[model samples]
Target: MELQLALDLVNIPEGIALVKEVAPFIDIVEIGTPIVINEGLHAVKAMKEAFPHLKVLADLKIMDAGGYEVMKASEAGADIVTVLGASNDLTIKGCVDEAKKQGSKVLVDMINVKDIATRAKELDALGVDYICVHTGYDGQAAGQNPFEDLATIKSVVKNSKTAIAGGIKLETLPEAIKANPDLIIVGGGITGQDDKAGVASKIRDLITQG
Candidate 1:
C-alpha cells in the first residue's frame, strides 16, 4: 500500500510546507480539487518543482475533455491525473490514451457512481491506471466512507489498481488497511493534526506493516 497526502485546504505555499514535513512518508502528493480550483495547475507545477523526487497527482476530477485536461496536467508536471467515473466511456478512454502519450497516469474517481462494482469493471477495461473509491466532504459529513466501496471495486476490478480516499485518519486507518487498497489517500487526517509529521510517520508505519 502507498500513502498519498491530499492537499485540499491549503494554498501552494502551505501545501509545500505540509509536504516537506511528511514528504519521506508519502509516495504521492495530491494537489486536490479545491487547491487546483484556487491555485490552478500552478499548484501542481509548484509542488513538482519543490519535491522532484515524489510523485505529484493533480485531482482534476475531470468530467469531460479528458485527453486535453490530462495533456495540460502532464505538461504541468503531474504524474497522475483524475477523471470522474461517471463520465462517458469515451471520455475515460481518452484520458487513458492521453496519459500514455504524456508519460503520465489516469485515476478514475468513483465518488458518487451508484453502481461501483459494475462501473469499476468497465473502467478497468478502459485501461485507467487507478480506480479510486472516494467519499466527498458531504458524504463524510453524513458518516459515509469508502471502505465497503473499496472492497467492492477490489473484488471486481481486474486491470486497474485500486485506491480509497476521504477523511482517513490514524484512528480509522487500520480499518482501511484491512481492505488493502493500492493507494490510501488522506486529507485532513494528517493535515488537520497538530503534529503533522508525527501523524504521517505513524500512518506510513501502518501501511508498511500491512
Candidate 2:
C-alpha cells in the first residue's frame, strides 16, 4: 500500500510547504481538482519541480478531451492524471492511450458512478492503471464514504490497481487499510490538523504496519 496526500484547499506555495513536511512519508502528492482549477497545471509543474522524488498526480477529473488534457498534464510533469469513471469508454481509452504515449499513468475516478462494480470491471478491461473509488465532498457531507465502494471494486477489478479517497482520517484509516487498497488518499485528514507532519507520520506508520 502507498500513501497519497491530496492538496485540495491550498494554493501553490501552501501546497508545496505542506508536501515538503510529509514528503518522506508519502509516495504520491496529488495536486487536487480545486487547486488545478485555481492554479492550473503550473501547480503540477511546481510540485514536481519541488519534490522530484515523489510521484505527482494531477487531479484533472477529466470529463472530456481526455487525451489532450492528459497530454498537457504529462507535459507539465505530472506522473499520473485522473479521469472521471462516468466518462464514455472512448474517453477513458483516450486517456489510457495518451498516458502510455507520454510515459505516464491514468487513474479513473469513480466519484459518482451509480454502478461501481459494473463500471470498475469494464475500466479494468480498458487497461487503466488504477481504478479509484471516491466519495465527493457533497457525498462526504451526507455521511457517505468510499469503503464499501472500494470493496465493490476490489472484488471485481482484475487488471487495475485500486485506490480509495475522501474523508479518510487517522481514526478511520485502519479500517481503510484492512480493505488493502493500492493507494490511500487523504486530504483534510492531514492538512486540517494542527500538527500536520505528526499526523502524516502516524498515518504513514499505520500504512507501513498494515
Candidate 2 structure lDDT: 0.95
Range of the 10 consecutive residues with the lowest summed lDDT in candidate 1:
151-160
Cα lDDT of model 1 by residue, 1-210, tens digit: 999999998899999989999999999999999999998999999999999999999999999998999999999999999999999999998999999999999999999999998999999999999999999999999999888899889999788899999889999999999999999999999999999999999999999999
Model 1 residue runs over 4 Å out of place are none
- Whole-model lDDT per candidate: 0.94, 0.95
TM-score of each: 0.99, 0.99
Model 2: weakest 10-residue lDDT segment is 16-25
Query: For candidate 2, lDDT tens digit of each residue in 1-210?
Result: 999999999999999989888888899999999999999999999999999999999999999999999999999999999999999999999999999999999999999899999999999999999999999999999999888899989999888999999999999999999999999999999999998889999999999999
> Could you tell me how far off, in angstroms, the CA of residue 40 lies in candidate 1 after the best superposition?
0.8
